[model samples]
Target: MIIESKVIQGKKLIFNFRSAKKEDASNLSVLRLKIDEETEFLDREPGENFLSPLDFEKLIYEDSISEKNIFLVAEIDDKLVGFARLQGNNLSRFRHKAEFGICILKDYWGFGIGNSMLESILMVADSNGIEKVSLYVVETNTKAIELYEKYGFKREGLLEKDRIHKDGKYYNTVLMGRLANKLKSQ
Candidate 1:
């Protein structure tokens, strides 16, 4: 099934959200590297020495099992600027839920791109019979936490010292989730 696309305008950007294609691997890889370099929450940095094009194609495109995963890309005038992914848990007990993650170029933050991507994902999850969607955000990312809350995701739990950043500081990661029934009622 084709996911519907949407556009949101900001002071300087016209963000477009659409399903990611195989051809988008290269551009998406670049965007991922750039975003990783700018954010401390990501597990690793994708620097000049990292991010092979072949690896991107294999992981993001060729090996993707679309039935259990949905990949979305955000573009501006044909340039890939961000990406969001939803993947279901493999185990039977957790199969009703999906995990989500999104990253936008630092320049694109605050332009509503993140919110749009998230809303789109939630819609997709709801239509696909996904009962719950979950994500983890570093405690310091107040903006993201607020946005998640606005989208009906409540704080589920905290993973104390879940991650250690490059700055030599440990940060807690907060888990949040929302149920499809609750979203529909809203």
Candidate 2:
């Protein structure tokens, strides 16, 4: 389930995008908290993430074996900076779809990492027989919404006050989706 690494050059730095490895568990665990602390666009707050490195290792192992799952990471000089996941349900009725999520260190926000990761996930999803990929984004994340739209994902619905942040404010979440055939038509 390893995707070939693609080297990306941004204005300030360069990085590689590849599938996450078991050896990366510790790094991924720490990076997850760092990125979560850096953005409100993520579902969790700074200290809310409780997944241990062992948990990440287990998840990585599971993803490697399932055609329906994908976990990718962005590495710069061996440092993990960003990651994305496409998680599919094994239930018969839900097998055709997967839930997508992604996060990047705030310092690397505009380096096209998110764009590359989305393309990678979609490509893998298509190959794995996933017909639909869906995700929920904070209503205020216009940049992310624009990126998803560019990739043929359409806004489907809105959940009012779905997330209560550390700032003591309720924010709406926008549900978006992309279909395999839908992208082909586009």
Candidate 3:
């Protein structure tokens, strides 16, 4: 599922969001690590489950051809700054649901990049007949939680002690889901 590139004008900054290209593999490899290390909200540690360039190449290539998946990248001046993915299941039991994930660099926060990514993902999900879109967020991520809720996601449940943060204390995870619908704009 290829998304047409969209140029979003934030309050000040402007950036492009588009389908991940094969050449973006190396940058996506590094972007993932930087985002994970910069924030504890994501599940992975900096180097855990690290995917090399070749690994990303393969994954992106596969995602490029998969009808049930989409990998979108956000860029400014040709530099990758963030990414999001919507992964749908092929099995009959879970074909109507998809999982969504997004990561933006700290420098790019507060620029409506997340809103664009999410709107695009939901568009794809709705077009594909994906009735349910789900995501997991750290319980402490109030800003993100608010954004999800603003977009119609409802808290489904909580996973207690789901993550052990840098402070050596366990934190809960919020499971959220939204039924697919037309894209909403702010």
Q: Pick the candidate with the highest lDDT.
A: 3
Candidates ranked by lDDT: 3, 2, 1
State the lDDT of candidate 1 residue by residue for 1-186, as single tens digits: 246677778556787788877788778777778888898866664574466667766656632555556788898988888888888776899888999999888888888888888988888788888889999999999999999999899999999999887778899999999999755576
Q: Given candidate 3, what's the lDDT at residue 136? A: 97
RMSD after CA superposition, every candidate: 2.8, 1.7, 2.9
Q: Which lDDT tens digits does candidate 2 get at residues 1-186? A: 677778988657789989999999999889998887788998887868577899999999999888899899998898899999989989999999999899999888888889889999999988989999999999999999999999999999999999998779999999999999745676
Model 3 spans with C-alpha error above 4 angstroms: 182-186
Task: Estimate the TM-score of every prediction.
Answer: 0.87, 0.94, 0.95
* Candidate 3 lDDT tens digits, 37-131: 99989999899999999998887888888887999999999999999999999889999899989999999998999999998898888888888
Which pairs clash in model 2? none
List of clashing residue pairs for candidate 1: none
lDDT of 1: 0.81
Error of 2 at 185 (Å): 5.1
- What TM-score, to 2 decimals, does candidate 2 have? 0.94
Candidate 1 TM-score, true structure as reference: 0.87
- The local distance difference test score of each candidate is 0.81, 0.90, 0.91
